[model samples]
Target chain A: MTEEIIIAGFGGQGVLSMGKILAYSGIMQDEEVSWMPSYGPEMRGGTANVMVILSSERISSPYLKVFDTAIILNQQSLDKFQDSVKPGGVLLYDPNGITIHPTRTDIEIFQIEGNKLAVDMGNAKISNMIVLGAFLKIKPIVKLDNVIAGLKKSLPDRYHHLIPLNREAITKGMNNLKPFLVAEMILK
Target chain B: MAELKLMKGNEALAEATIRAGADAYFGYPITPQTEVIEYLMEQQPEKRTGMIVLQAESELAAINMVYGAASTGKKVMTSSSSPGISLKQEGISYMAGAELPGVIVNVVRGGPGLGTIQPSQADYFQSVKGGGHGDYKLYVLAPASVQEMSDFVEDAFDIAFKYRAPVLILSDGIIGQMMEKVYLKDQKPRMTNDEIIEKYGNWATTGKKGRERNIITSLDLQSEKMEKRVHRLMKKYKQMEAEDLRFEKIACDDADYLIVAYGSSARISQKAVELARKKGIKVGLLRPITLFPFPKKALFDLANQVKGILSVELNAGQMVEDVRLSVEHKVPVEHFGRTGGIIHTPEEILEALEQKIINNGSIRHHKTRESSIL
Candidate 1:
């Protein structure tokens, strides 16, 4: 199985790192993976996106137009990538700064209070991990153990102490994800 | 055992240089390729293997430094984006003319002038057909993946020293910026100065003790001697073409439509070929790994089997001309591309194949188009 995922948000939101962690996890499981990012000026302060692919077979295109899952963090990303999700695919987002939510009917839309959970955990940096946890809850493409191993591999040794907190954030995100009722929101 | 690590292509290439036992890396940082220098700086290969990494003030300085280091029979390299690469053309020409061995990497971006920081293959003509002045050729290798990006460093150096010619690693921002799992080979120890003198002593200026002094210069005022030098260079190029042409064919045996591409474009076209095959369109992909000794003979041979060929690139249409020339108007040849950093999608490629080759079965030759334009 091949999983093409796009993770988009502000540069500081750990968008690129989240994708890196997922890719590392794929590697831990002995799977082929590729991570291509929208680099340059946008990576400084503006929106940043990374295309992460995990495949049982060889991955063809590193840059993709459509995705099996889109883990969007900000409103701008939601606007840009909502239509890019494949039909029956998953669109997981953090209900933080998003004003315009995804309105897709064919795909599954799930929202996790990633920002709030991260703040409550005393580190807003773990917000991406929360969203990643919610993604795992929806589709466990990679094992949790591998993700923890991935965290160890991706994070520098100095940040090793915070792995438990990040792990906690992931668990919190997994439990708190709520399916968004698009029709009800439209009616309101 | 080889160490397996997940690394960005640029980072992987940088680390490979150290493992390849390179003597020095001199480069000015540029977007999409700066990570190469950054990784090298962070790794501090000087501590581990005594490999020197210096940030030159400019691309010109970096390339000249490569020239100086290479002249001493040292393994030297420099990398840059499209515009910066353009700046180093004069130095590159000097290296080529002087028959100095070095590796020059161009992590190509959209261009004519500082076009975009995003990936592009627009430098095809510039790279394959001599970017610098003179009739010299740089052995060009276009790596399609991160693994190739890492692996080609040693390969480039080997070819460079073997032929005493510069080798170009023609990459793009996509390959440079993307991350993938790469198995890095074990570290090889750098050759000692004595070893260098022993190996390249005849040609290299390792100081004159008992032997005649070696002079390194591209200048020969006598026109007859200059022509002979150029002829000798041409012979080396011809030798490279005959011996070192490398390419890959994907599902070409039963294919009716063919796609010829290299570097990042080739990687994307691989997907397009798969997509077309899924839709019952018999398509194949020919990826040229060596751009200078470009898979001309391969394309010429494949032309006989395939009904039509489409050259895909990030440029408007550059390699298509080469494809057309190789096939000798054997069948219809078309170019489908996106410019200024826009990478074409697989679906769009399939659509182009359908419209340009499958449905519109016309044997449109380059000469005809050129004459028509004239």
Candidate 2:
């Protein structure tokens, strides 16, 4: 099995870290994974994107043209990668400040109010994890246990205290995921 | 069993430098490769393995420091990107002239002059064809994956000391910045001074005890003496070419066409090979692991079997010249690439193969394609 994903958003939104966590989780599950990020000037106060792949076999190319899933966190990312999602694929996004919505009818679209949820949870930094949890709920490609293990491995020892809170955020995200209205998408 | 961990390619190379028992690392921080020094400084290999990691003031200083450390028969290395690597060319030539054993890394970025910080393979001509101002060649190893980014450190050091020649790990920003699972070997201890004396005493300036005073210099005023020294350097390069050539072939047994590439381009082209095969096109990949001791013979043999070859790189066709020369223009060798930090996609590569190699025969060597078109 192979899953090619692109995670794109602002630099500080943990786009890279979310990809890293997914990569680590794939490792924890004994699968091959690659994480290739868009670096240089485009990362400073601009759009940041990372191409991530997880496969049972060895991954051929870390850089990809299209993705099986596109996890977008901003309107710019939505606009950039909406067409990049493969047909019959998944497009997950956090529609907090997004002015534009994805209009792809051939793909499954899911939306999460990640920023608002994180604000309600009293920790705005956990929004990425909530979005990740929403993705896991839809696909369940990686087990929750492996994700927690991946989080433990990626996070420093000093930040170990926040694992439980992050887990709660993830659970909340999974519980609150909403499918975008296909009818509304066509109208727009 | 080895330690399995997920690491960025630059970080893996840094950790491998420590684990490979390197004596010192002297490098200037450059984009796409700053993580090499960052990881080394954070890990503090000095505390762990008595190794030294210093942030040199400039690339020139860093390379000269490597030359100095390598003169003592110590396993030493430095890392930088394309522009910084260009700065160290003189020092690299000097080390080559002095027959110093050291590892230099160029995590290449797009460039003629500070072009971009994104990944590029434009330095192909500069690296394999001798960038420095001498007829000297570094044994260039192109690593395609993060695992090789880590593993080639040990292999490069071994080959460097074996030939008493400078070795370069020719990597690009994609491999430098990407993260993947890598198997790291156990830490090896650095050699003692006594061991250095025993191993490299004849050439290295390892204190010059109980023998004629060892002098290390690439300078010889007399023309005859300089000619003899150059011939000896040529001999060493020849020996490396004979014994140290490395390459990988995939699906070549039944291939009608071939793709020649190295480093990250090879990885991308491998996917293209797969895509082409899915459409019932018989294509293969030839990845030259060592660029200096290039797999010319392998390509020549494959040229006899394949109808055409597409040389894919992250540059505007540098290695294609080498590919043409390797096959002696027997096959239609065309180049397909994207320059200035844009990576070519696999679909585009296959499209180029169909268009440039299969369809378009009017470009060059039309006579060669006319006979092979059958």
**Of the true interface contacts, what fraction does each candidate have?**
0.81, 0.81
Where does model 2 exceed 4 Å of error?
B363-374
Residue B289, model 1: Cα distance from true site in angstroms: 0.1
Docking verdict class for candidate 2: high
C-alpha positional error of residue B13 in candidate 2 after TM-score superposition, expressed in Å: 0.3
DockQ of each: 0.84, 0.88
Which candidate's DockQ is highest? Answer: 2
lDDT of 1 by residue, A64-109 (tens): 8899999999999999999999999999998898888778899999
Report the CA-based lDDT of candidate 1 relative to the real structure. 0.92
TM-score of predicted structure 2? 0.98
Per-residue lDDT tens digits for candidate 2, residues A40-60, read: 786898999999999999999
Q: What is the TM-score of chain B alone in each candidate?
A: 0.96, 0.97
Each candidate's number of clashing pairs is 0, 0
Candidate 2 chain B lowest-lDDT run of ten: B361-370
- Write the residue-wise lDDT of candidate 1 on B66-172 in tens digits: 99998888999999999999999999999999999999999999888989998899999999888899989889999999999999999999899889999999999
List the TM-score for candidate 1's chain B. 0.96
TM-score of chain A of each: 0.98, 0.97
